[model samples]
Target: MTVEFAGEYFPIQPGGRFVVGREGDLSIDDNLFLHRHFLEIAESGGLWWLANIGARLQATVTDATGGVQAWLAPGARLPLVFATTSVVFSAGPTTYEFTIHSSEPTFRETRREREVEGDSTIGEVPLTLSQKQLLLALAEPLLRRDGTGMSAIPSSADAAARLGWTVTRFNRKLDNVCDKFDRIGVPGMRGGAGGSATNRRARLVEHVIASRLVAKADLTLLDVGETDPADAE
Candidate 1:
């Protein structure tokens, strides 16, 4: 198996293991928010498994196309089943990503894109144009990034400013979007009535990318800026 990050690749022998974190076989950034040894990649039972060794952080695992996803929380592990598996996680205000390449993959993508029926339903999650714009603002940096480099998820205020709106307006729109996602049972989206604000932005972005809820094509919304929901129709 091989790991790709920032245009660099590292091959992992079946007998050996690779560690990813602030300091490990693959040393990441110097951010104090990250664990010294966070994620562990090892071969078990003839399959490569990616495990989250950290107690706080969780990883978003998906196929290269982002059609399938799995959350790898602490103490949980997932097998690298795709030919190219991508893992995304958030540490502090920054989001990090990496890709695992297996010479022999157990699954391959065979599904193709179908026509859209009505509102913007990204993976069956209906989104309004305004909500889509909100997501584009939150996901702009991540969308612009290439390879496996770390990207900072903008703060709500920053994202609001990016969209030329007041913080209150941004938060309102955020609540609406989160509510829609919760209705469809998207995990970690945010529970109604009592939901903490911490990590909500990061988790949203992580899930959006890993679940293929948003893609680069949506980044054009950032340039279009804020718009009326009716105008997009």
Candidate 2:
């Protein structure tokens, strides 16, 4: 098996364990928000396992097709069953991602029916074109990134400017989008108790990308504004 980040690859020997974080075998970065040893990958029981060892941070695991996804919370472990497993997470203001390729994967991608309805959605809650534009603005950096690696999440103001919108307009849209997701049982979208708006944006980006709700194809929405209206209501 091999792990990839920024085009560099690290091969994991059979039965060997590898650690990843701010200070681990992968040493994701020197960011203080990242744990010293966040994720551990090991060959156990004739299978590869991905475990979350960090107390504060969580990782998003998905298959190569992004059709299957799981949240790896602290102490959680998942089998590396897919031919390629992509891991994504956020630490502080930056988001990092990497891919794990297994030479002997147990599971393979096949046609699967859509579990949720709508062209873009969460639990049947469809995303408006305007909301999609907001997401594209926020996710532009990550979409433009070269490979599996770290990218800086744009601030609300920066994202707003990218959409050719005023801060007030941008903030209002952001509030609406967050509120929509929050109502649909999505966590970390609310402020005050959950986290600050800054943290919320990072979580939003992490979830959307991990779930394949937004892709590079959606980035073009920025060029042509959403016709849905200022107030989607």
Candidate 3:
């Protein structure tokens, strides 16, 4: 197996364990949310698994269904069931993203093989200016702050206020943006009706940031001095 990080790839031998964290076999120092030994990947009984070793942090795992399957807290383990899986977590002041890949047979691999046989092409969807602005606001809470205090993820209302919109208006627009992404084949953007509102918002923010749909330069669009009359409460 092969593990890729920061444009570098490391080969993992079959049945050999690969440790990933700030001070593990794969040292990921870019994010402080990672522990000394945050995660371990290994093949056991002919199946690959990912285990979480962080004491406090939880890893969000998105399944083939494009919804969160589990929050892998300390002592938790999840099967690597897909050809590629996205893992996200927040710690301290930063959110981290990791992708796990497998060379063995998996649902995603089967789907890709079918696509290749059929010669299918996936197209990209363009974001409108308004959608771009909304994405920027949704991502603001995760961006680095300037003050000396401990970083905190902002509430939906706080993010709305930053964009000069009421929470209700912001949520309505957020739903619309999520629907747009869903129609465009973006994973993890669509939320189920059962989860807590806070979790849904967090998932949306994670998806937006992880997908690179929003960036620091896009924040400039949020600085528009005037608010839309329709967005005013």
- Clashes per prediction? 0, 0, 0
Candidate 2 local lDDT, 80-183, one digit each (tens): 99989999887876778899998888996677676686565445557777788889888888888743333477788998889778888888888888887888
Candidate 1 structure quality by residue, lDDT tens digits, 78-196: 98889999888877767788889999998767767787787765436667777888887887788887532234667789998987888998898898888777776777677445434
Candidate 3 stretches with Cα past 4 Å from truth are 30-33, 63-68, 108-136, 140-168, 171-204, 207-233
Q: For each candidate, C-alpha RMSD in Å? A: 4.0, 3.7, 8.0
lDDT of 3 at 55: 90
Error in Å for residue 132 of model 1: 1.5
For this target, which candidate reaches the highest lDDT against the unseen true structure?
2
lDDT of 1 at 45: 94
Candidate 2: residue pairs that collide: none
Cα lDDT listed for each candidate: 0.80, 0.83, 0.68
Please state the error at residue 37 of candidate 1 in Å: 2.0
- Shift in Å, residue 11, candidate 3: 2.0
> Model 3's lDDT to the true fold?
0.68
Worst 10 residues of 3 by lDDT: 144-153
